[model samples]
Target: MQDDLVRRAVEDGDQDAIRAFLADICSLTDMGFAAVARVTEDRWIACQVLDKIEFGLTPGGELAVATTICNEIREHGHAVVFDDASAEPDWRTHPIPILYGFKSYASFPIFLSNGDFYGTLCAIDPARRRIATPQVIATLRAYAAQIATLLEVRSPPTA
Candidate 1:
């Protein structure tokens, strides 16, 4: 139920908009998969996904929170980006990429207006791609903020 709410919030009652936004993100970053995932301490639920490479996850699909790098983004509220995980010293041996078979990865934190961590806007590609450019990072940040604003506006008021 909680995950459903978060997914709805991320969708903001507009499936077309969310889909288009994610498609744009994939195009912008040259990634085959892009998703907005609702991450909690124990779970990672996909809210929206654009899967060009048939990576096999759809909206509402769940992944073990422990297996995702987004969990770390949730911990520190920072964006993680790598042009080629297999070539980057820090991520070359990291298990997530190896486990997922993705060469390029990027994830940006999404926070609500009240400063609560919501989840992440992340993308991945099986082939190494240049995704860590300043322009791409800035665009991802802007998209994240846009998502946050939509969620904030659509969220139900607190009791």
Candidate 2:
């Protein structure tokens, strides 16, 4: 059933359908912007961006943040959320949002079945939004899992 949904999403080039399907199973969480990025040596490539709403940044800015988050996730190997970038000491001076017009973000690393860190699945908002519930986190994690599965299936097998 899930595979069918995923296949349909891929076939239709429907990023929102993919994200919404995952969110429905997990419960809609975090204002509904999700993306999938592909990690390469020393950098990440933004592959897909899914959103139920629109924001001010251009596609380029979105791609840039996706790449940045992918790199960060590769280094950290976990889920992260910047609820209030302005309040976060570590990120207060980070020119990402100010430069790109994005303010809030949540992301998780997508790992291949072999445990290789491939990239990340993320949600971003131009407003300072908080994902403060365990359910929300769980939902994001589940969506990340689905993304990982998709990546694994799409990637050529390494022999």
Candidate 3:
């Protein structure tokens, strides 16, 4: 299965823990979709996912890196939170939300312990809901740190 390949790429240590972390993200945020993606300049592959809203992406699903909001997080090394794209003047015509059919979305850049960009921890929902709460953002940032820790534990980058 492709998930096997994806899992091996990110997890040389604990797989269940990472999956549970993603699940915890969705549960805590009330998001229908949560994913840990492995991102590069040219690719965005889902390494783990908790998709309850039928977003149709699996563990190994690939989306164009350039087209996804995760790419923005990757490039800027920042987290984005959109409570409702449809309500925001800046996001109303944004291609990503329109293309993906998600009204509420958030993404945080996942970095390695060595400060290298790894990917993103992102969640989305179709309903227009509040997701920019302090508690949710704090939890998501913590999850990003935890994912980085797992990556480091799996295999630290060579100096």
Query: Number of backbone collisions per candidate, in order?
Result: 0, 0, 0
As for candidate 3, its clashing pairs are none
- Among these predicted structures, which one has the highest lDDT? 1
Residue 125 shift from truth in candidate 3, angstroms: 0.6
Candidate 2 residue lDDT tens string, 21-138: 4455323554546666655454444455555556432221324433365666677798887776778887777766566456677778877777887667777666777664687778
lDDT of 1 by residue, 1-159 (tens): 555655574465346766777999888878999988878888888878899999998877788999999999999999999999989999999999999999999999998877888889899999998989999999999998888776667663243
* Each model's lDDT: 0.85, 0.60, 0.84
Cα deviation in Å at residue 22, candidate 1? 0.8
Q: After superposition, which runs of candidate 1 have C-alpha atoms over 4 Å from their true positions?
A: 1-14, 156-159
> Each prediction's TM-score against the native?
0.91, 0.70, 0.90
